[model samples]
Target: MTAKKIGVAILFIVGAGVAYAETPSSLITGYTAEAARATPGFAPSAERGQSLFMRKWGVSKTMPSCATCHSDQPTAEGKHVVTSKRIAPLSPAVNPKRFTNLAKVEKWFGRNCKEVVGRECSAAEKADFIQFVSKGSQI
Candidate 1:
């Protein structure tokens, strides 16, 4: 192939890769950075994230924890126990739309954390939570 043609092919391949490269974990970098401001050298852990997702906080008798809506399996569809509203899968692996928007994500976290955890989720918890969801809680 000519050098010019090869360069064009490479660009096309790279562009295609980027177009399909969105992952839930990519959102964690910003959360991790924010977490570092409060807890220096913060690193998200799947275990912590899983715990956060699964554990019942009992903040609301209606919505005990994230699992109360998201389910133990991040990939599985769930419904709101009280409202009966259907909830999409949480894992980015299975749900391409899981974390594509920053504003919407933050809005949900802010609302849900207060309703479930009884407080706003910190940067660390948010990172861990996203990390856990990104991994589909496989660990």
Candidate 2:
């Protein structure tokens, strides 16, 4: 292959690899920045995230709070309230793959937040949630 072709291939490989691998801190930073745009100087709070996680909204009788399905301990495995399917731990400390994919993170939040919180979670909430799970009670 020509040098130009090799350079293009290298860039494509590197870019594709970076695209899917996300850290909990990076995800929190992105969401925090997005939230700051609307609420100036806003920062993610693990406390708030924990509150959201443990609060029972009664929106879904089967899955009211995130903890209802994820368990009170973020690092512990859980089971789906209705389906009874096994769920992996939510904390990155116990499950390094938890927040590695931005797409999967967003997909679960989109589905779970509406079902539990009764509305879509804000960017701040997302950041806060990641902050909470990433720290796993460290606050």
TM-score of each: 0.81, 0.84
Candidate 2 lDDT, tens digit per residue, 34-102? 778789999999999998899999899888899988988888899998989999999999899898766
Name the weakest run of 10 consecutive residues (lDDT summed) in model 1: 4-13
Maximum-TM-score candidate: 2
Compared with the true structure, what per-residue lDDT tens digits does model 1 show for residues 1-139? 4343243234334534545533455568767766786789899988998988888897888889898887789989999998899999988888889987665676798789989999878778878998988886558
Clashing pairs in 2: none
Provide the overall lDDT of each model, using Cα atoms, as 2-decimal numbers: 0.77, 0.80
Clashing pairs in 1: none
